[model samples]
Structure formats: structure tokens, C-alpha cells
Target: MGRRSDHSPDELRELLVLSGHALMGERGFAKFSAREAARRAGYSVGTIYNVFGGLDSYLIAINSRTFRQWGAWLEAALIDAPSDRAGRIEALVRAYFGFAQNNQNVWMAIYDHRIDRSIEIASEDDAAREGLTSIVDREVASTLGLNDNDARRLVRSLIATVHGHCALWLTGSYALLEEKDPAGQAVDRVLEILTHHLTPSES
Candidate 1:
């Protein structure tokens, strides 16, 4: 036989998402195309429609997958954090860097304004944001005893810091720093700053 060919519709959809992510990472959203995504995913144009309804829907599905992966990684990392406040904050910071390193492309896509423009065409963007908000609310805020507003603010700050750090790292601005474990030290310092802000006494 040529191959086993065991892929189901769900499996094929997942593959399409993976392929779309790869293309977006390599050439970005403006340059990515449905035909290219289908080719890379080992599917036909018709199959892409069957799985996602259309090109815009397919891109939304891909973006949703990226958010889902991010949420899962965050949840797993938080679950293993120490119960103490400081320890939990440190774990969260480390988890941020860990996710950046492991999913640099997807992370870039998540924050890239170029890709954000695609949100106008699909409803999945809102779903992805909701999923992310849930993680931030439960794992980051609830663990630290903050109210919903504080949690959202703190999480936004943390995300902003990580995004700046990751963007610089990706653009080679941290080449010298990278020579000495830049990401680790950067994450530690971020955790220190955030923890100080989140301290009960500071409230």
C-alpha cells in the first residue's frame, strides 16, 4: 500500500490549522493564501471549504487553534505552580517565557496587528479572546486573590511585558543578552516587578 491513510475529518482540519500557522509564521497573514494552506495541509480547496466554510473561516479556525494551544500551556504550567503567592507568580512568568520559546510563531501571530485585521471576517476571534480571558481570570488572578478587574489589569500588564520582551528577542535586539540566558533573566525580573505590584500590602 502507498500509505495507511488514517486521517479523519477532524484530523485533516487540525492539519490545515497547523499548515496555516506555519505559513502565517513564515510569510505572515497578508501573504498567506487558502490555496497555499490547502496544499501544505495535503488537502484540496474543496476540502478546505468542507472543513471551514471558506478562506476567512479557515483563518479563524487557525487563529482559534493558536489560542487554544496557548491556554492549554498556561493551564498546565499554572497547575504545577507552588501554592504560595510568590511561587505562583514566578511560575506564571516562567510559563510565559516557556510558551514564547516553544510557540514563537504562534505567539507572534497572536499579537501581530497584521493578523488582528483578519478578525473582522470571522467570529472565532472573540471565542479565542474569551478562552484566554478565562485562563487569566482563573489561574493568574484567582490564585493571587484579586478581583476580576484587578486580575484583568494585572494579566494585561504581564502580557504586555512578555510581548515586548518576545518581540525584541525575535527581532534580534537581544542577541547579546541571549548569549547570557536573556529570556530567563528577563522573565525573572518581570516576575519580581509584577509580584511587587500584586502584593497584598500594595493594594
Candidate 2:
């Protein structure tokens, strides 16, 4: 039986999200069940729709939480990283691989859950994404001496470049291709781009 008044509205919202996150981590997106998540939280499935609008919004909330966690993982990785361009970038890439591998289910859920473009997620929910982007943008800007806007613009493709390598590695596609040192390849490719971006005087 589900509890009726054990938690406040805010607490219920948080509990549901935590419950859903754990389920996503356990089942990934393909097998995740909203009913199961609510059941774990000692609530009815209708409570999820009532509190979060629908399954998609609840997932957006979960993914936003994941973004914050990923950002923190990156920060932790930098704690022992060398204070240099290549080293910092390498640390970021390795952290990306480590986090995604260690938490593949939840990590993949971040990409697997889809929503419409026009739907509005609250600003606080997006703050996590902004923090993750800020970390990458800062590193890229520092390495290449680019302004904030330019660095942010470039960070998109730069992230994709590394993500392609990491994703392939995770799914074992790299092994199928017999690719060696994919992480090293991604790091070197990034460094090559940074080196090529030198100003006329430096070049």
C-alpha cells in the first residue's frame, strides 16, 4: 500500500526523482518503468503524472540531475590533473570515459530520453547543463586563447569529437574496427586542433 501523507509535496517530488534515477541506473531507458519507480517510492504511478506532468518531464528532471553529477565528476578528476593544456584536456576526456563507463545505464539514459524542442524545462534544471558547459568552455578558451563566445561555439564540436570516440569505445565498436588507443587518439586530435589555432604571431 502507498503512503498517503508521509511526505510533503517538495519531498515527494525529490523522492520520486531519486527513485526514478535509481531505476534508470538499474534498468537503463529501454526497460525503465514509471510504475516501478513510483512503486519504489511507495507511491502510485498517477502521482508521477500529477507531480511532474508526464513521464517525459520526470525524465528531464532525472537527466538534469545527471548533468550536475557529471559536472561534479569532472571537477573531481581535475583535482589531481596536471596544470597544462594537454593534461587538463586528457583528464577531462578520461573522466568522461570513466563516468560514463562506471554509470553506463544512467549515463546512457541521459541521451536516450527524448523530449520536444518547445517544451520548457525550468531554469534551475538547466543550471546543471550550464555548469557542465562552463567547465568545457573554460578549458577550451584557456587552451586556445579564445573569447567566451568563440570558445563556447567551438566547444560544441569539440565535445562531439570526444563523445564520438567515447561512445564508440563504450559500445565496443572501436574494438570491431581494431582501433588502438582511442582515448589517446581523441586527446591528440584535440591538441592538434588547439596547436593549429595559434595566432599569426605565435604561429
Candidate 3:
């Protein structure tokens, strides 16, 4: 960043998000600092507070960006996924594991950062964060031939199943369980859940 004055307001906001996102990637939530983010974006700490209102708001923006990036990564991973529904779900599960393994710091920060209760999440940022779930909800609806409400309900349950497996893998708890191929297990669990709703021919 040559001069903070060189960037317009929108540019500055983008820079702030990018800087904070990068910082979270490198140092994770515990070590994250708005001061460092401002320094990286070539601005004073006061400038960040003035622009964003507070650290919680700033963190939400950064984490929302992370969610978008994660969604992109998942989409890219599915590019060569098999044509069959089960295969595509398998690809999604594997990609979920792959992202967490590859981007440990930033991935964990998505869960680790907690906003102050008083700070309401901005609508745009909340929507960005929800995008990941939307993808899965759509897929679930298509897979089960269900309506939007049913799909949303089922997606939440299946996501919890997959997320648990991913969390176990991340925390090295898989070793304790003597498990192999946790991603495969996640795929299996997802399919099992769908099977409960499927007719024999559909299954």
C-alpha cells in the first residue's frame, strides 16, 4: 500500500477485509489484531475503528470473506466430481476435509471468532456467511427431491454429521477413535441420512 490516501473509501474497505483475512490466515483468531490488520492495510488502528465501528464488526467482515473463499474452494473441488449424485456428495465431503486440512488457521478462525453479543451482524456479511449452507441446501434438495423447507431442515442435520467428522479429524481425535478415512465416513453418514427418506427404487 503506497499511501492510504491513494485508496477511495470502497477500496479502503476492500483493503481492510483483505488485510484482516490474510492476517487471520497467517496468525489465526487468538493472535489476530486489528492493529496489525490496519498496519498491513497501511492505515492507523484508529482508522479501522472509525471505518468499521469496532473490532467485532471488522472480524465479521473478515470471516465473511473467509466463508466466500471456502465456498469458492468447494466449487473448484467439485469441477471434476463424478456425475452421479452420491459421487458429487462424496466430492463435497472430501473437499470439506481438504479445505480444513489445507487452511487450518483461517478455517478454524471461522469457528473461533465470537462477536460481542451487542454487535448485530450486518445483513450482507450474514448472507455471505450463509452462502456455504445455501450451496448444501440446494444440493440436498436436488438429491432428495424435496422442497426448500424440507431440504433446509435435512441439510442442517447432515451438515452437523459431516462437520462433526471434520472436527474430529481436525482435532486429531480420529487417532483416539482409531478411525481411517473420516471423509469417507462422512459421506457414508450423509447417504445414510438420505436413505431414510428415500424409497427403495430411489435409494
Give the clash count for each candidate.
0, 0, 0
Global Cα lDDT for candidate 3: 0.84
Candidate closest to the true structure, highest TM-score = 2
Error of 3 at 169 (Å): 2.0
Which residue pairs come into collision in candidate 1?
Answer: none
| CA lDDT of every candidate | 0.69, 0.84, 0.84
Runs with alpha carbons beyond 4 Å of true place in candidate 2 = 174-177, 200-203
Per-prediction TM-score: 0.69, 0.91, 0.90
TM-score of 3: 0.90
TM-score of candidate 1 versus the correct structure, residues matched by position: 0.69
107-193: candidate 1 lDDT, tens digit per residue: 666655344454474555677768876765565666555677877888777767766766677657744444555556656766676
Highest-lDDT candidate? 2
Instruction: Write model 2 residue lDDT over 1-203, tens digit each, in one string.
Output: 55657888889999999999999999999999999999999888999999999888999998888998999999999998999767898999888878888988888888787778989888988898789878988776766667767777778878888888877876777352687677788888877877776576654
What residue runs in model 3 are displaced by over 4 Å at the alpha carbon? 1-4, 145-147, 173-178
Ranked candidates (TM-score, high to low):
2, 3, 1
Q: Which pairs clash inside model 2?
A: none
Of 2 and 3, the candidate ranking higher by lDDT: 2
